[model samples]
Target: MAGPTLRTYKAGSIIYFIEDKGSDVFVLQKGRIILISNSLDSASEIKEDVQKGEFFGVKSALGAYPREETAQVLADSVVLVFTPVMFEAFCTKNPRLVLQMLKVFSGQLRKVHRKVREVLGETGQQENSVELLRTAESFYKMNLKDHANYAFKTFLKNYSTSNFATRGQSMLDMISRGQPYPVEMDSLETIIEKIRLGEMDVSQNAESTNFGDMQMNDVGSMEPPPLDDFSQPEDMHIPDMDDTGLSNDDGSGMMDIPDMDLPDMDIPDMDLPDYTPSMKKPPQMNVPQPSASKPALEGITQFYYDGVNEFSKQNWDVAIKRFEAALSINKFENDAEASFLEKSLFELGRTYMRKGDLTNGIGKLSDFVKKYPRNPNLKKAMAYIAEGYEKKGDKQRAMALYNKVVSMPPRDKESNYAKTQLDRLMK
Candidate 1:
């Protein structure tokens, strides 16, 4: 079945002059080939490099062309010869591959054009334009999400420098003042602008406040502007105070109006519900008002533990249900979010895992990993995850994870136990 072509070349030898037979084609099986072009001396220049398992010369094989380049061997080379017949037969058998190749070529052409434009545009004077080009190039090469993350981080740095400290101060000030007092968004904006423009700086006592504390507040207490009122504060005029704390010395403006400077006038007391900033509201037994419940997750969890013990030990199903009920109560509690109560998620996840319900166990464990990536029990949760996988009959995956455990240095006594268990499984 062999054809009449046998070609061999020593290292650093010219296999064939591409110009010698324009219609000849090559299929490389062993060795490296460099295609050189446009140099008076063939050995002096290499335009394209090819290696084993590569096929070239298709363009020259058809009578419509001359060899655009010379092919040489950079190392000892062997190639299978393909006359025009073999190539035509391949194209006939797989028309879908032809279409796929054409699509790939079209995509490459577009990519090249885009790169050319980007390189040209990168020469522009604007930094953002240059940044954008670089971002686009990076996105093209490494994918968009990583570049998006970089861009987001850049935005975050500028944002934190200008806003984080001031906003934190504003929120703490609101908390100190009690009640969700009306904050002029424009005023906050102006403060940030002044800071960015160097008219002001972050106060020397800028203490960091956890954002979790802020979100813990009941949204109902924060009475956002009435739904249909789209008015911006920029449309309203507030008097500018001078060194004397007076509006205008001319005495002809609202400054002349008596009682206008009263603090009560600025902050009115209305029948609108008393919206305090505390995470929890006190229990009301004799007094009757609609009070919000603000139990910490810890209390709810403890209550569940107590309830499980107090409930009939004879009715295991009821005890299990009681435990689940406790979890539900803990799930709704928000007061402890800002402090030590934050460990609730880990507790809840561990409880679910102990319940031996794979769905809830996996769900809680996954969420714990997301919310607390650096938690001490993360490895333990991962071990539970492997158990869950095993429970689901994914033995291959379980083995892969067991291998990881065997390789890892134990983090602590618990992890040492896990590693020991993994070794026994292997045995």
Candidate 2:
């Protein structure tokens, strides 16, 4: 109600599909929908059914491109949408809502990042989806028609008995109505098989934890569907005229990205070499500035776009490459560039950390610190460096950095962060 205007789509209409970009949080007011994705060949279609009173499209377009899947109207549907601008305004108007939204963003982004890492083989698999699915069914007390399907049975045995069943079930519940399957069964099968193999490997190595106490007890059910208070059909209509200056309910038509919030970023400070008088001229500059490198810049921009695609698809390796390439081309401009760099470095470090190569992670963190000594994120970089050192069995060095972080002049977030790290180190 506080966000954007509402829109309605007839049944069978395609809302959006894989690779589309925009931020319009769709809230289903009526009718059913299907979330789907097709492989490159357009042969494989994975479908997930979304029910009424649910939200989709909100999570996928979080300032990223190439959405993971497509959404089709399964029936005459009514959806209330929120654009990023509208949502930001809502957050500004409501601090409580901001807190809740921040929590969701933090947890969801982290989860998606981890999933991308796992799927890209950048991180070792912890639990396979077969077990995840089985755990979901068991957590819901589902009785399968057949136990002969090894896939389904193993899913049950591992998921139902493991300590992570609750979390697994929650994921299923999110996708249960949203229909998150890909267009290709083969792709789905590939993912499934990977999970299965990963699970088997896990089983061979470690004892499964008991999940008897992992059940969620007091979670609140989702709120009822939002109701519109319009009194008449004509009330929704407006006088037709040229230059109406009206935007869609999603407000994407009015989209204009403001300067990025660099203060909130976790990045390093790098000294950008100023362009000399000669370098500023195309004829004299050696760095290939087609239009002073417009073509190369475009190529790098495309790479960043593709990286967003990969990031959305949970392909962390590919996404990281794209981001790295974009950084190489030209560091982003304004605060957006800073945010991108910070996020990229943090994620890159995280990817290495997840792979159990803390030494490499520490090196990356060190690079950030050396480059951006005055950056606010320098504090985070140092903290991560300390963590990396500790992970690499260099506790003495870790403690020294931790002490330095806490001893910084400003008694603000960085100082607090340093304090937290020092306390952790001491502990």
Candidate 3:
């Protein structure tokens, strides 16, 4: 139940990405912000300018769903950030704000309905249910358990009496029990063979498969049902406001607005949830054993070198794919392979940063630091982590890390770099 906090973002900074967990709402107070999304047809980008004094992230945050668009700072801006509870309280005190938000929500819903109709083209409810169920199955096959869970829940919510509902509920139950969806042994063997022959790219498969895009496509295939069908039973109920109008509880006509250019204020730190993949072993699968001609360690080496080559060429996405493939091979291998694994992880983290995915970058780098505390690249990795924090608007934590680097021994290039950044931040 913490209150709203004011935060600032610089131009060229991303506030959040599509499919990020939506935990807080934002109201633009000054400067410019833009919400970026893909068109329903997936043929173009859609950019919506956020007007001053308007809310941008309300729907997803309130519904406890993933963000549907990316919010980017178009100019240096000040924004008031609110948790869902705080937003509800604010709406209760200013019923007019709720009315305004309703107008925006209605427009968005209408657009979504129209788009769904265009895409589905008179599809029956049964077909819609089947499509949604298939989407959930796709996620399950891809080993994206969380996404599969969400899609299954969405399917059950919309089509609980459909023939597929029982299957969807079964999948949900398995996910809750931490069980992986079953894959055919022959398909698993084929994948392994393709991987060994360099005929398939696991990195490409992992990186290119976007859960949000798949979910959206499934949504487009479904007939738009009544709003009540999607509504949660535990939704918050808003009370009717009396005729006294915008008056405060103490009779003040309206709450005062603060200056847009107010000085930097210290807001409590809000750490984002860690998104590191778990190290659990997958369900056992029987497959043909590998030939002695091509050892498993060789595959790891090839993935690592391929990643390095891609990184050298400035192909961030490809490099990330390769490094992730290498890391996925074996984390508990011998010392030589372990070294390659460590380097692959480090490069993967940096590649993510280059691709503007700071969350995963920081997570991977942090994991590297913890697993290999005495690594030769420890100082460099720490400096990169600090830079990621700085870009993410956590200047205080960034400065603290920079200070640590400056105080470390050897006076290396990384320490020098950290010192330079520290001085710039101090200004």
Best by lDDT: 3
Write model 3 residue lDDT over 352-389, tens digit each, in one string: 66566777777777777666655545556677778777
Question: Which candidate number has the best TM-score?
Answer: 3
Pitting candidate 1 against candidate 2, the one with the higher lDDT is 2
> Could you give candidate 1's per-residue lDDT for residues 1-427 as a string of tens digits?
3342657878888756756665556778888889877754344665888756556775666654777677878888888776677666666777986577568668977776766767776333324422443343344234354454454345434444432433333333333343132221223233333344443344421211111112212333233222211111111111111111122222222111111011111111111011111111111112211112425444443434333232212233443443444444534433332222223344344344444455565565556555544443444555655565556555555555545444444334335545665665667
Per-model C-alpha lDDT, please?
A: 0.42, 0.46, 0.60
* Ranking of models by lDDT: 3, 2, 1
In angstroms, give how far residue 30 of model 2 lies from its true place.
68
Ranking by TM-score: 3, 2, 1
lDDT of 3 at 51: 91
lDDT of 2 by residue, 213-244 (tens): 11112112111111110000000001121111
Which lDDT value does model 1 have at 385? 52
How many backbone overlaps does candidate 2 show?
20
